[model samples]
Target: MTVPTEEVAGAGAPEPSAQPWWRSAVVYAVYPTSFADGNGDRIGDLRGLRERLDYIAGLGADAIWLCPWNPSPMADGGYDVSDYCDINPMLGTLEEARALIEDVHAHGMRLIVDLVANHTSNEHPWFRAALAAPVGSPERERYLFRDGRGAHGELPPNAWISAFGDSGWTRVTEPDGTPGQWYFHTFAPEQPDLDWSREQVRADFDAIMRFWFDLGVDGLRVDAAPAMAKEPGLPDYDLTSYGDPTVFRSSVWVDSPQWDTPGIHEIMRRFRSVAREYGEDRMFVAEAVVSSSQRLADYVRPDELNTAFNFQFLKEPWGPGLRDVIDETLRLHAEVGAPPTWCLSSHDEIRLATRLGRTDTTAVHLVDPATAPTDLELASIFHRSGEWVSLASLPGSWA
Candidate 1:
């Protein structure tokens, strides 16, 4: 996994002025569960991550961005956070997390943790109270809880679809054992969306930021950054452009009532101010998937996030289309005075080699190993092996 120092330095050289370390630093995204299993329970923990600091440092990475390690129900792979201030016992303890942070700094590498502010696990205390409280109570106001439509309240509040291919609204059973109000879940029902409109929600996240920063964390990667804000009215989407069976279909409409609204920018501005309070070196990166490059740039405005994931590059084919995206991304990011962050693959997406070796690159769908055709020639050419290897082996070996 060692990267050539010359290449790393050239690719991540900061400008000759006072600039944040994140502006020009190679960051490795670590999905903790599978990164390294230190406890021998077959689950990666803080000890495992600490043990791998040398390995990551050897790879010439300037920082490591860890996926959510907070206490969670594991319903959405730890993205359904139950506690923002504590470490998941299954992963490790809060002391171990602090030790890992110090250990990472000892190796001269920064640590950026995933901040899942958009949602919380249904099992979270806030969500639990929301469920127990009567509809329209303050506890319910912390989350997006709305009464269902139609007679007998049998229908979802709106036709918004979850990212996981189901209705975004999940009905809860009242204390009397009857169907109650529906709660919004942008991703999975187990992860209910938090109402960012609540002042307490904003203040709570600000405190979370301070807690992590005070713990020696270098930065935060905001999860579901764009969906944090919704339009004033919970409006039904016009599914005409989304095509039939639009449950999991990608929405091209950036102005949708549920996605990329102006309120998100204000939230980002607040987050940016919080990060600055710790130090100018502390940073925030947005995981926003918007319609256009300009829309992506909006997340990294001078007063907003430090940078955003350039997802267009990951979806583009290796041809003129890729070049066009890169050119546009550079131009758009420059216009906003932010560097373009490129990623070929991610934990949520298919492996880069697999995507590049596929015959139909434009499909943009998750690869189903059971039904996908193996491009033996392409795989051999790209990976230099006839046998398919795991993502861990492919990149390390190729490098």
Candidate 2:
């Protein structure tokens, strides 16, 4: 859908850097709620974001990866997008979004927004239509809806486990009020995985890309990038097998039945093509939590994404473990000729400051701020901020 906006001219921005903007750029991730409150509503909005552009620019950021500003149920922190083209009413309006884009570019920085491609909010229009449609209908095919394995359809279709620690499949009630098919969700049940095998699903994403690019977004950060494609036949997977890191393939999700499955590269290539149509510098940075360095590199092959989050590096504790990961990452990415990407924090993961103070440093899950260690300390236990900055001095770092 075309996101309507009045004429908003790009401000007088500086020339592009000698290198690709993202290569040596510090892409700042801005979560909307607490960044600033422009309307005195105690929540962040585009107006607030604009007001702080000078402050952000002062920090020497090269781009802003605005965390999900799309209309959503707030499940998964706005990753459950209900409308891909429009801004969340709480955050701002379409016009404000346009102005924010212009403001961002005007400051000589690019804007990257989230593309929750692997799934949609359960309340999405297409998903609601799918729920209303009968089994075996085309609407149902747009998502991963399958009949239950049991005789009365009482059980989940497979034993697939969600990252949030529940059955990946959720059984739904039919329109006639009967027990019905189970739908897949890699995260919360509020977000249902889209069936990329469906052409309409893929096409809609292509349209979504153009809509944002037209609005002047410089790139897209693909949410749940690995889980886009799944193994065929909805087969049950051996959960125990996943614990053996050595056994995992270069794709990370090969034979896993869900993440980074066989056809994900093709889907990413399709996404890349869409971005390329806009411009070569219009790029994609995948949020890929893969099994190994090789798997991470595979996601950023030239034909696929321009870069992917170096999650292994993020999850490593300081010292030998961290060094090994960096070495391995550089080696693998060098092979693919893709610039390695690194990040300190992400919407889905714990902040670097908090994680650094934790006893179990490499654990990547988000913990309640109160329950987790307090902010990064200057004590003997925690590594200082300067160390981290120096370590991440190379290109493709996100803050």
Candidate 3:
């Protein structure tokens, strides 16, 4: 498990200035709702973001990575987008959104909108159409709908578990008013996973990418990047080996049937090609929780994505030991000629201050993994071949 720092010095890696602006830019991430409030509604909106443009510029941010601002049920903090072409009513109209993007650029900063292509809100028009269309209709092909197993089709089609700790397969009642087929979702039931294998899904996603890139979005922060593609046939697994399915983000890592599958690279390549249409500066950064450093590197190959969040870095203990993570991360990204993005915290992670308080100076520090729930699965990512690392040793290791 020891990483040779000499072989991968300055794991902080290269000077990517010769590349796109986004390569070395200091991106200030904003969870729109709490960033600022406009019009006194107490929820952040595009108008508010525009108003803070100067303030963000003052902080030296080269870009703004805005979390989901599209129409949603707020089921997963706006990640469950019901519509990709418009803004949420609560967030402001499309016109205001355009104004914000303009303002962001005016301040010499780029805008990276969060895109949840992996799944759509159940309320999305396509999903609604899929629901009303017959089980085997063209509409159903847009989603991962399959007939359930067992007598009367009462069981899930597979044994996959959701990231939210439940069965990934949810049975849908037929339009004819009887118990029927199942649809898969990696998160909440409000979100339905898209069938990336289907032509309609791929075509629609390309259009969605164009819709935003045409509006001058510099890049996209791809949510659930490792998902969207699943192992074909959706095979069953012996869940016990991966640990508790109820553990948050801890299940389905090793030989997972739901994520980081072979087909995801092709999907990324397709999306990367779309980003390329907007020129070299228009990039994509993946939020992929993969099993290994090599797998993480694959997300940013020449024809895939531009960059990806080094989430595994957050799992390393503070101080000297943290160098291994930095070296490994920088080494992988360096090998692929892609710059890596690093951060202590993101919208989804626990704040840094709280994580630091749990560790001591001497000996091995028992930080987040020691104090938090056992099912936090970052442990599996660091699991090297023929080595069994304990879940309690990793720091801040959840998805």
Candidate 4:
């Protein structure tokens, strides 16, 4: 697809100084365990993060966005949070988190915590309570549930595929003798999806954010927001080639209503409203992945997230043809009118160095998609994308 560069030329006017520093600041994404090790425990903790604050600050990042350090089963690498209120025992404690935040602030940098509101760890008390509560009970309503035996119940809520290539739903059994029921999880079987349609669920999340916002968090990085809302009827799809269940447990709802759900926007607006109440400016960076640029732009409008990561670069082939992709990248953001957040690499991606041709130039030269090796082109695409894009963790002056 050809992306025009008109939008890049008109992306934004100069920002006023009074605006939040994060809005214009570069960020460094830190995976705690890999960033540094404190106490020589071989795991990254808040204390380790504190000790490395200078390294991060030296990178010239305006802030450090910590991946979920909350207590978790680590089934999906800490995304499955068991306690939003406490730091992971593997990472540190509440006291350490406080110190990390203080240390980050002292370095003239802010902290953006990852809030995976879409789901939580199976070990979480909420999920355990949800398992025991009756279908109509307040606790049960916190999670997505369907009768396991009914015709509609036999299938999951929808056919939406999980990001991880598996059925998002899992059967829940009770300690007492009882029929098993399906619980929705868009990503992993162990990460139960929240029933955002339920009022109590929304309230619980609001309170969860408040618990942290009140603790002085600067912002939040929302994970998989587009999948937050599921279809009400919970439709199913034809089986996949492997004969796996067509319906992913997490989403009973798919494009039936619209690609982007109204409920998702409502929830984001509520989050933003609450963020405004706090003294710090709460910036929302949406991690939305979609095929069409129009669909991606929909997530970053004035009312939704402040910015969304552009995946065009991630999908492009490296070479001179990359100019079109880079141009398109800037153009797409310009059209959205939201400041673009360029991403060459994230946790989910293979390192850029590995993608490029393993040569001295590191695949910097562009190649023709029709003739060049796919890997070489991809490497070049990522290399060029990084040249001008701002990342949460990488140095801004790269390339």
Candidate 5:
């Protein structure tokens, strides 16, 4: 299985010292909602994060990738951003966020925040204006709002499914309480997908990037990076024809007009330029959930994002499958001269220990909520020295 090098050829190389700090850094992902609750509000806030900075620094993590702390409605676990510039009041004020950054820097650790460019909360001012505006109005153009299919315009515009297991299109209610056009949402309906084809959308993201970068954010972890750019003209797809729809490896998922399109690379390149304007140390990492190693590598090319999460490694089972994914990830990243990121678990994923102790370890285990091991089973795995050694071997870093 020979890997192609054309995608990386002639890519402008940065000087070794100018390389982003994330290349060999251990970045600990912090879910701010649960990390700690400093104000006794039963919800974690910037104060909590600030209080725990020492613990994170002591853990030897070079940086901390914070999940969305931006003002959100808590829909989709804070992925539905309502305001890009302000911090969530429930989380803390903007002053606290700034102080957290200063504290992180004081602890000798860098800070990166999640950037959800693919979608925005339904409560966002732009989206609210879009709901009131007539179809084809300038406000509507900010999102992927389109006329529904069928004679009565009752059917969805396309056969696309949401990542959360439902139709991707959500019909809106017009100001006069009439049925309205449907809008695309890759995730939940509250999180409507933005129409990246619009220059205004691109410009808005550029401002959002600068807003954080200028405030001293070290990096951004772009959420749903690949889905930002969709193939023109939403098309119907046959989900049944693809084997194992649950696995991203299925052709239905990979070849869909909705994901990993070539246009997304250009969008990423533009984002790369924005990061470059900040300094060599500023970085962008993509959360592109494609199944192919080559497709994943494309996201981290020299002129694109600095790195991307290796979901292939995250979803692989123990033994040969895991080893093969690690090896291929290292090789593919090497071809692009990019570093690979590794993780056993994330806020959206089950804990690493529980996942490894289960009898069936596959992507299916993740989707099936009931597949978790019993308490005794988990205890047994923890008590075994051999299991501990095997679990330790599962963590892989960039070579």
Candidate 6:
């Protein structure tokens, strides 16, 4: 998930480059954990990814964005990282990561890894140590922790709920022997949020990026980036009291403190600087869920992400009228004042084929290509085909 603060050289401080490939590229998203298994362990690994490279290329994609493959406890589907540099043992080894990179390049395709910077798993060493320290200790400061006062005499610093389920804050007093404090986790209790307000936390995250970049990754797909900065006042939220706001997409606190906070842009600038340093054409893609065009524009400033994922297309209701999604995309592009990219599917949601009812094979019909019986030979064959046909003038089939 994440690491603690430590002065790391060659991190955010990087030189700028002229251009990067992501500016005009189409990337295919792949969830490696569910793609295919190579070792027969029912878990996808680097070798499996290698096997599927040709298939991905056949789609006319310029690159592929892989979901998290970092060493983890499988708490949140490998989004929880135990080590920044090592590959998860169940997935594969570091050697496999290197080989995958080489193979991807050989096929003339780029690769992007999903970076979950907002939090780390509770089992992470840094979080473990932070949980044990006193309330005001520096280690505890790396995470969001404060003493509780009411409702069991101890509660989290805020009431913001997690994306998965339950309260975002969890009591970390089991191992530590003292009146415990609550730590903030935006997704799951196992994933504790990092204090980006602290300079050390920012620098620590930058170092993690450098580690992967040096390993030859083309770029990153920033996961949950808008949720990086929590509101400082620890204001009580009305939505958190009733139900999880994530599924309905109703609450503003799901992300964005107010809308277009300068802090979020600064964090992205630091990451963009890293891409420039390598002089490698890298794409910085943001996974933002802001509904309005203006809110979406804030994340994709020319100074920030080159391509931000567009969800307006995926949020449409199915019917004969499909222009609403197209109209929304054009409106968002014009109103938001930024270039946008669209995705038809992601691992977190349902497949479009199933959602659109296009998977019903029983409804498909063949069509006849002949018109006015110009050729009796072809017409006789078509008459004898005995197949379901929708139209009589189509190119391939007849009935």
Global lDDT of each model? 0.79, 0.79, 0.76, 0.66, 0.79, 0.65
Candidate 5's residue-wise lDDT over 106-135, tens digit each?
A: 777778899999999999999999998998
Clashes of 3: 0
RMSD (CA, angstroms), candidate 4 = 8.4
lDDT of residue 192 for candidate 5 = 96
* Candidate number of the best TM-score: 2
Question: Residue 36 lDDT in model 2?
Answer: 86
Output the better candidate (1/6) by lDDT: 1
lDDT of 6 by residue, 120-183 (tens): 8888888888876777888889988876668774766665666665677787664546557887
Q: Which stretches of candidate 4 lie over 4 Å from their true place?
A: 1-17, 149-160, 237-260, 320-332, 358-399
- Backbone steric clashes in candidate 6, count: 1
Estimate the TM-score of every prediction: 0.87, 0.88, 0.85, 0.80, 0.87, 0.78
lDDT of 6: 0.65
lDDT of 2 by residue, 1-399 (tens): 221122211232334334666777788889987788999998888889999999988867888988899999998889899999999999999999888888897888989888988999999999999999998999999999988877798988877877777678899999999888999998899999999998999899999998887777888999878889887887776656546432323234545767777689999999988876654567899988777788779888888999898877876655577788888888888888788877777766776665656555443354334444443453233356566566455788887
Ranking by lDDT: 2, 1, 5, 3, 4, 6
Candidate 3's C-alpha runs over 4 A off are: 1-18, 246-252, 358-399
Candidate 4 matches the true fold with a TM-score of: 0.80
Question: TM-score of model 1 relative to the true fold?
Answer: 0.87
Clashes of each: 0, 0, 0, 18, 0, 1
Q: Please, what are the lDDT tens digits per residue for candidate 3 over residues 35-128? A: 8898899988888888888987886678888999999988989999999999999889987887787777777777888989999999999899
Show pairs that collide, candidate 2.
none
